[model samples]
Every structure is written in structure tokens, then in C-alpha cells.
Target: MLSYIYALAGQFQLTHERLSDMPAAPPVLLSDRQTEVLKWAAAGKSRGVTADIMNISEAAVDDHFRRIFKKLNCNDKVVAVLRAMSSGIIHL
Candidate 1:
């Protein structure tokens, strides 16, 4: 699951970089899991479905989202998604 998440995130990150109209981040690094969570969130997947797709619990998804918010310095899911997009960590 982790590997899938990581690869998926990297793929979306590259896609987001090529697509979004937002400013990119200054190359800040994130853990593979964090990037994955951000990618799903940015792509508008709810916590439960993301959890299912990742084969994790919904609570685990929420927990990851909290961690993602902290790592990205974002206040909420929307901001986190925007940040993820801007940072090329998720596609629009």
C-alpha cells in the first residue's frame, strides 16, 4: 500500500507540475506517505474512499491528513490541496 501510494503521489506530482496554474513550492521535501495523502486529497478524494483505495482505515486516512496538514503547513483540506497543487505534489 505504501509503495503504491508513493508511486501514485510521484506520478500526480509530476502531472500537477505540468498542469496547475499555481506557483510551485521551492522544492520542499515530503515523506512518500505524506505526498500520497496530499495527492489524493488534492484530487478530491474523500477520506473514506482514499482509505479504501489505499487499503487503510478511514481513521488512518484522517490521521494521515492531519499529518499532511502539518507537514504542508496548511490549515485545512482545501488549503492543503492547493498547496499540494502549487508544490507539484498533486494534479489539479
Candidate 2:
């Protein structure tokens, strides 16, 4: 019974290691402009400022955030930025 237990434990360990070795799911896809918007947002920039810096209109920035929210599956910019950072979609 002890040997059987050990064998089961060994198999479990190998399975656990194999699972860990598996690649993570691909990150959510975002457009280049969306990424830029999220990057600016991560840096604590407001949409207005990001628009000014990116030389786009505020409405354009708003549109980007709307799409970003959909892509990242988040409603708020802060959550979207956090998800993007965590998912390797964007860096700080």
C-alpha cells in the first residue's frame, strides 16, 4: 500500500510539472493604437492628456478606450490597464 501511494505521488508530481510547463493562453489582442492608449493610461495619463500627446481628438481617445474595454474584458481604464499589464499585453 505504501509503495502504491508513492507511485501515485510520483505520477502526480510529474503531471503537476507537465502542467506547469504548458504555455499560457495567448494574451488578448489589441490594436497598436489601443496598446499606446493603454500604455499612456498605465503611466497615469488621463484620456484628454493622452489625446493631446498622441495628437488625436478626445473623442478618438474615448473610442480607443471603448474598444480597449471590450478587448480587455474590462469596463474601467484602471482595470483595463491592470489586466493588460498582468496579461503581458502591455508593460508599465
Candidate 3:
């Protein structure tokens, strides 16, 4: 499972690198904790599991994802993870 995630991330990186000729989008800044949460999400962790691993409440985790969604202009966790990976915001 983890290897599959890594492979997907690798593909995103490769695709982005191949598009280097295009003008790059403005860098999207995320807090350290937000990045950490997205990393766990990229690892296929559930919200409760991510909260437990981070020693934060599930509500906190949800809040982080909400902010992440807004920042990434995404509405779903999977989309947010893909955007983050494509933008080199997080790695597997």
C-alpha cells in the first residue's frame, strides 16, 4: 500500500518536472502542522488515525484539512493530496 502511494507521488513529481517549460504557479504556503497532516493523508491515513498519530483531536485534524482544502482549492482529501504532491508540497 505504501509503495503504491510512493509510486503515485513519483509520477506526480515526474509529470511536474516534465512541465518545467510552463510558467510555474505561485507557491502555496502551508504551516508545518498542515504539511504534516497532508503527508499523513498522502500515506492513506484516516482522519482519526492521523489525529492519534499527531496527538491532536479529530476536530483539529478536520480543521487542518478544511484549511488545506481552501488553500489547495480542492474539495476532497484525495484531490488535495494529489495537488500537494504535484506542487512538491509533501512527499510520501
TM-score of each candidate?
A: 0.62, 0.70, 0.74
User: Which stretches of model 3 miss by more than 4 angstroms?
Assistant: 1-24
Full candidate order by lDDT, most accurate first: 3, 2, 1
Candidate with best lDDT: 3
Per-residue lDDT for 1-92 in model 2, tens only? Answer: 86456545645644564479666545699999999999998787987999999999999999999998887665776667766766788986
Ranking by TM-score: 3, 2, 1
How well is each residue in 32-75 modelled by candidate 3, as lDDT tens digits? 99999999988889999999999999999999999999998776
What Cα-based lDDT does every candidate model obtain? 0.72, 0.78, 0.85
Between 1 and 3, whose lDDT is larger? 3
Which candidate has the top score in TM-score? 3
Model 3 residue 21 distance off true place after TM-score fit, in angstroms? 13
CA lDDT for candidate 2: 0.78
Model 1 spans with C-alpha error above 4 angstroms:
1-27
